[model samples]
Target: MASTLTRLGAGILSKFGRSVASPTRLQSRPYYLYSPEPFHPIPDKQPLCMTADEAVTVVTSGMRIFVHGCAATPIPLLDALARYGKEAKLHNVELIHIHTEGPGILAQPEYDGIFRCNNLFIGANCREAVNAGRADFTPIFLSEIPNLFRRKIWQLDIALIQVSPPDNHGFCTLGPSVDCTRAAIQNAKYIIALVNPNMPRTFGDGVIHMSHCDVVVTGTDPLPVISQHCCSEEEEQIGRLISENLVQDGATLQMGIGSIPDAVLSKLYGHRDLGVHSEMFSDGIIDLVNKGAITNAKKTIQTGKIVSSFAFGSKKLYNFMNNNPSVVFNDVAFVNNTAVICQNPKVTALNSCIEIDLTGQVISDSIGTKMYSGVGGQVDFIRGAALGLDGLGKPILAMQSQTHKGSSKIVPFLKQGGGVVTTRAHVHYLVTEYGIAYMFGKNLRQRAYELIKIAHPKHRECLEKAAFDRLKVMPCP
Candidate 1:
């Protein structure tokens, strides 16, 4: 058996123009054979397990460090870095990541000079820092973030990641957040992993051999959980309309976390063979999979598998994903690629917006100039779904007709300085509790009329007058 395995390892290395000295049996379990690249041999030296503070000493001044984001964020490492930076008076230590949860101690005012943040996606923790000019926000699609590292546009010196413990084959999984962290792990000069037993061992592109990690710190804290909230009456109504009208059987779905998406998923219990190819998902998807509602039977891409880049929800969701081969966690670049997403049949991309103008302009990431969130994979999936195979797919934008303050979300014009995450041309289906409006290829005047019809009852009259005045057309009967 040892001789046979040595031959197999040698054959893989030879194909990559590399050689290993006497392939030793590193672990009992077989190496995963899915990734296209050849698996490098495990190092002879065992990984040094240490405390968070000791492992973080590898991070030096002026280094660009990548932090794993979302549910898989390495909190212990981040906290240690914060303490070390302040004590050592470290300067110009740049931290980069997508949206992360928790208090974000590094982004606090006291760490202004010691630790600087370059956020790819602004979450609640970093919003104040970005607005206060203590940190910076990068407006880019989630699909393009991996390329930024792979192409060496933003070279990373170190990567702080949280991962599952090494399986028998000496392989550790990145757990919930494969996303950009896969690229960071591959490209970064050094890797410091927080080995947490609580993290689910998800399969696919997130799996990495422990030989890749330079240092490992034990962390057993519970993974952060974002509970599902009940949708309001209006949101429930809109969700029902979308599930009934737009979502068809065998449709591939891409949706974010929120009450509206949860409401939509709840209503899809009766739908057949639904597939998910989303950037991120929450607990709602687990129910659908268990009920056999999402068989992925008719998907054109990765058929029979639920593909996602990351996940965050209740502990039940993580437990559902633990060592589950049915759910394949991949990098965001592959999951959110326009070309890849378009391959799936009936690709329905459901996204939300902060506000939208009468002419179909979407404001999602920011309210006027203030950055509320990041320009995520909304455009990528929208454009991909719009061009679905044989034109069977649809991109739906669903939001409440009005804010909690009773202000209209559908306006005559977007607030001044608002960022248009989705342009007029990319918007296809717009939904509110009032009804659905198809806006693609419609003239400005026609769009205004269609949008006003779906506005809240109290705001329709004022919206119509503003539309008529701006569009210079007679009010529709």
Candidate 2:
């Protein structure tokens, strides 16, 4: 296995070299027997539109398939695949993707043997299947997902995608989610697209000529929209602390979706020349962009563009991204690359965690033995921001002091079976409603004291006692 992986790595490096030399290059050798011609917009040739059933007929048993994920999941294509699996009794079909939103019919218990999901990031839709041993999850960084397909580590037979209709030039956009779908489309043996009029015609590397798609099915279903909740007073307070204490003017930002990130963006109205280069962003950024707060003027990379791999938000957010030249959607590998991210000046990476120990270990993916979320791009952005040019970047982990049930999120040690997504060496700034805890360059005892200081007042005493009992360090009264 080691030797095989080594060979694959070498082959990828060779291809990478060739690709850098020639941007319009194609693979010299095909993974499958059928190889489509180079993509070019055919001005006069009309597309052969078909029904969902007709498109699904091309799928055969034992073929590896790629499903577009997130809000852009191809529902029509997925439903067709499920129906086909049931009607044809297909077996050994592998479905690969990241966190997808929706029912995920292929992952249903009835299709256990017909379709097996290999997920990079597990979502609520497939969590039950994974836990029940009907599906499998591969713990990996979002930054490296595109590499798996681009490098041919996993040769895909079919690519199922949801895209906007072709324009005058016969080019269609991959819409809101582009993370690894671009790579999948480029590498897959056959491309099956669910062309939807509702999918936003987003700009950037997401645009592809219609000639690349082998089968196209038109649908009118509304694209999924994820709404953001109003941040609580405590969350707002934490956001203020982070914005005032850590975020600087002209800083580049990397943040994820949620209430905390929303609160932080709300507080950044006064900041100047702010830039966004996150793995994923939500509706909070739209207001900032409209107010000229996020000018993207001072970023070292993509200086005047909002760079992101994927986006999730309301219908308004989707409409805002349509044909927007300022927003540049790229693949996850480039958007989340640590080296590429640190090129920007004063990169501030805002992330959240499930829980953290006094020693500064972060548990962001799993809760005890249960997989809550995947280790998406926390470490990628954290390390990138920490190593920012000339110490201007900052990695801030923000969360509430207590859970909804009033339990302290700060603990003496991580719960058993909870994996550490970020280690002590990587943790720098920890923020809560109370205050900020600067953990960089601090010893274990000092870290414990600092963390306990920012913990909820009701739990501070108990946390200090636990730290003393575990680390044999006296608490500072």
Candidate 3:
């Protein structure tokens, strides 16, 4: 088992080396067939109810297991799995998922041979393991992750998920997360579910019958709580600029997590009939919903409903979505589809970046050689909003002018290994606290000059010098 893991890890490291060397040549490879799956689930069979420790006994060495992510991350099952694997002397049991939370013991160096993580989208919990070369990172768009399962690109042996308890007629829902779970369950040979009463009974593509479950473990874990973001002064300024200049009263919105997004949402209370169609949303939207700003009435698609793939936020946010027909959690394959997102009017996609080069190349996934987060839905919404139906769509990239360490985020060139998640060709608007830089249809010099104007005042002169050196043209009025 150890030898098999070494062979697989070497293959991934070699591929990762090439990806770092020539990013264009890097191709994504999900978990390969470690070994043959011996067990096949029977049809129309009732699930065997068991404790967490007993339910996890079905997992074995050399099998790829998909762990549920986000607010619905199964704590009890994972803790039990950790204990069981250590006690049973397990090895080479690979775990795959997107940005799950909790004190991720399984991905640490201590669990090297016992448990390994294959991350589709890296998160804070797994960031250290990924950077230390303990876990593997796959850079794929959220829109396409479903195909890995639905098309059998990645063979799954088991899917570990958490869900709301069974309703009358024995129906259970995937709750807050429905992004890729549907596809995972359809392809997995067996399913193990944790029935948590705290999981919100959401509406959309997350429905499953109890008969589909191979093993069921009951839990009463509370959803992980994220406190509401208090926007900084710079973030507030960016929010105001976007709200006043870019977002229309009836615009359909797409925003990612963090303080800037929350700030933008804070400023939108006056906007009317605004709709949300994002890959994921946080607690920011709850206030807008309360203030009658997010009526979802004017959206061209999914009228009168807020369409999202998954949600992560405070308990207040979850409570608002509980059994609420207005908030729909669908699969990302459909929700983040460019065609689907473009159908709406004034599609305003608000995204952030780690840094952006003078030529408008935006890097969000990594800093230099380290992978911080994954390219989840930045391109999905950026391209979607760029092709918006009414031509009023705005794809705005907002970030602070300078980092906390006083380094310029708008640079002459991207750091050597930064992943260009949004290309210069796709960039429309770049915002800083100073002002907005409209990059669409701009010449190289013009783009640099505009970006420099909004850069931190202290760095503008150096940026000008650097721009002249790189572009070989004086950015003059």
lDDT of 3 at 257: 86
Q: What is the C-alpha RMSD of each candidate to the true structure, in Å?
A: 6.8, 9.0, 10.0
Model 2 pairs in collision: none
| Winner by lDDT between candidate 3 and candidate 2 | 3
What lDDT score belongs to each candidate, Candidate 1 first? 0.85, 0.84, 0.85
Model 2 segments beyond 4 Å from truth? 1-47, 475-477
Clashes of each: 0, 0, 0
TM-score of every candidate: 0.91, 0.90, 0.91
In candidate 1, which residue pairs get closer than 3 Å at backbone N, Cα or C atoms, i.e. clash?
none
User: Which model scores highest in TM-score?
Assistant: 1
Deviation from native of the Cα of residue 72 in model 3, angstroms:
0.9
Clashes of 1: 0
Error of 1 at 355 (Å): 0.7
lDDT of 1 by residue, 301-344 (tens): 88899899999898999999999998999989999999999999
